[model samples]
Target chain A: MHEMGIAQQLVQIAIDSIPRDIENPKVEKLNLRIGRLASVVEHSLTFCFEIITKDTPLENARLDIDVVPVTVHCKSCDNGWEVTGPVFKCPFCEDGDVEMLTGREIEITSLELADELKI
Target chain B: MEINIQKKVLEANDTEADINRTFFKDQNVFVLNMMSSPGSGKTQILCKTLAKLMPHVRVGVIVGDICTTNDADRLKVTGAKVTQINTDQFGGDCHLAANLIIESAKQLGCEDLDLLIVENIGNLVCPAEFDIGEDARAVVLSVTEGEDKPLKYPLMFRVADVAILNKIDLLPYLDFDAKLVVDNMKQVHPHLPVFEFSAKTEEGLEPWLDWLKIKVFEKTGK
Candidate 1:
């Protein structure tokens, strides 16, 4: 699935962003903010991440993910509400023209690396 | 040491994409990144398009798929220079990233080409997120896939410069509301170009081909 590709990209990003001073810093944790509308399977991403990070700096890293819900702003009613399900219609005006404010994000927010700089 | 790396994962890909954009500009080539779901008839449309434009323009293709060279083989029959990249050999990639595309384009000798059509792996969501330095992005949607596709996959619709509703010939057999699909797409990307055409019977392809020619000529001054 696409999750595997995204996982690979995340690992690459982590590897590339490592500070030069940290001599093979052991990655402890990786946090990602994924949205429901991104159509990514979080379990699949985690599974793929584990496989992709093997023997790398992130081998033992814990993958943390936050599932973000889609929020829509109704243009007609000027109302803001969370998309309560797969249905994207506005609750107030029953309008589908609501603009999407959030969701559709697939970002790696932060990484926790072993403090090799102190040693 | 917990170092904070607030970097976008796709930054590397974007850097490669910038290189591709500059390369295309220098060569005066118009590139189109075609995206769609599996079984959306992307290759078929390419076949028809190549047939129509072969006489008027020089066209080349770089086809990406998870496995198999089936689409490339099909396009080769159209007498266009074609290159195939089976991303499975790399990592079973669902979408073609900019670095991979640039590598493939170089292998295909795209510098001499006027237009490069990149048939991205047939997955709507992932491919829409990646920018491959194409002059235009075309999202192909067939009538059998239902009308709510635009609403369900808004990112693809919103990112695409053109939405080609393929397989209009099957409209009589299927209960697909073409108008509803257009309306939904317009809601997301107002003023987006929508084209209804059938690759099988060669119906409604003239306007699309014409628009494509105009775009290529405008971009390349050819």
Candidate 2:
């Protein structure tokens, strides 16, 4: 799965983000925002993260996932709604010409250092 | 301590994709990313496309697969410059990322090419997730596949500029509803163009060929 690749990239970013002054920094948690349409499975990603971070500074880090909902706006009728299903048409206007406003994010929003960035 | 990163996990891929896009733009090369499920006749349609476009258009191909070069080998028979990327090192990468596209393009040398077609590794889910700096994205859905594939894999259809319903000749023999599949795709992605054709029989492929030729001419003036 591509989660392994994401995990590898995440670990690399986390390790590189450690403070230069800190002797040793441990990441306690990785805050991630994954859209509903994103191809990542939460548990699969965490599993890969654990294995990849085993010998790295993020060994103890756990992923905190936020599943973002798909949101779209109707370009014709200007109707907007949060899409919960596969169909993306506007409920009011039934127009398929809608613009997506959100729900495609796969980002690392923040990271929690092990209590004040201490060793 | 909290460190705010606010970075895309695949930022590296995105960055590379932008670079690839710029290169294609500067080189005036039209790139198409073809994605679909396995056995959907992507390779078949591509073979037909190359047969039709070669000599008229200097087409280059970058074919992706896990370990085999079978698709690439078939495509090379058309006299187009073809390069294959075997993703065995990445544990059989399910999709082709932007960096891999650029690597293949460089290997083939992007100059003197009017169009570059990327045969993304089959699998509707993963390939749609990765953007390979293409001018157009086409998803080929065979009628033999379940009619509910559009609903099941919305991302793949939603991101596609065009949908190719391959194997239209088999429609009479099978219970597959071309109308219903088109409707389903419309539901997932509004205004997405669907070209129903059989790559095997070469029926109804002209419109798709015209679309590709138009895109290439629009970009490369070829």
Which lDDT values do the candidates have, in the order given?
Answer: 0.85, 0.90
- Residues B1-222, candidate 2, lDDT per residue (tens digit)? 899889898889999999999999988899999999999999999999999998888899999999889999999999999999999987899999999888889889889899999999989999888888899999999999999999999999999999999998998899988899999999998889899999999999999999999989888887
Query: What is every candidate's C-alpha DockQ against the true complex, given to 2 decimals?
Result: 0.35, 0.81
lDDT of 1 by residue, B1-222 (tens): 555766656666778889999988887899999999999999999999999899578899999998889999999999999999898888687898898888878888876678999999998788887889999999999999978888788778867889899999999998888999888877666557899999999999999998899999999877
Collision pairs in model 1: A114-B1, A115-B1
DockQ of 2: 0.81
The list of candidate 1 runs beyond 4 A from truth reads A16-25, A35-39, A55-57, A66-105, A114-119
Taking all chains together, each candidate's TM-score versus the true structure is 0.83, 0.97
Q: Pick the TM-score winner.
A: 2
**Count of clashing pairs, candidate 1:** 2
Error of 1 at B112 (Å): 3.5
lDDT of 2 by residue, A21-91 (tens): 77667788989899999989888898988898887778978899999999998988887899999997667
Choose the strongest candidate by DockQ.
Answer: 2
Query: Model 1, B59: alpha-carbon shift in Å?
Result: 0.8
TM-score of chain B of 1: 0.96
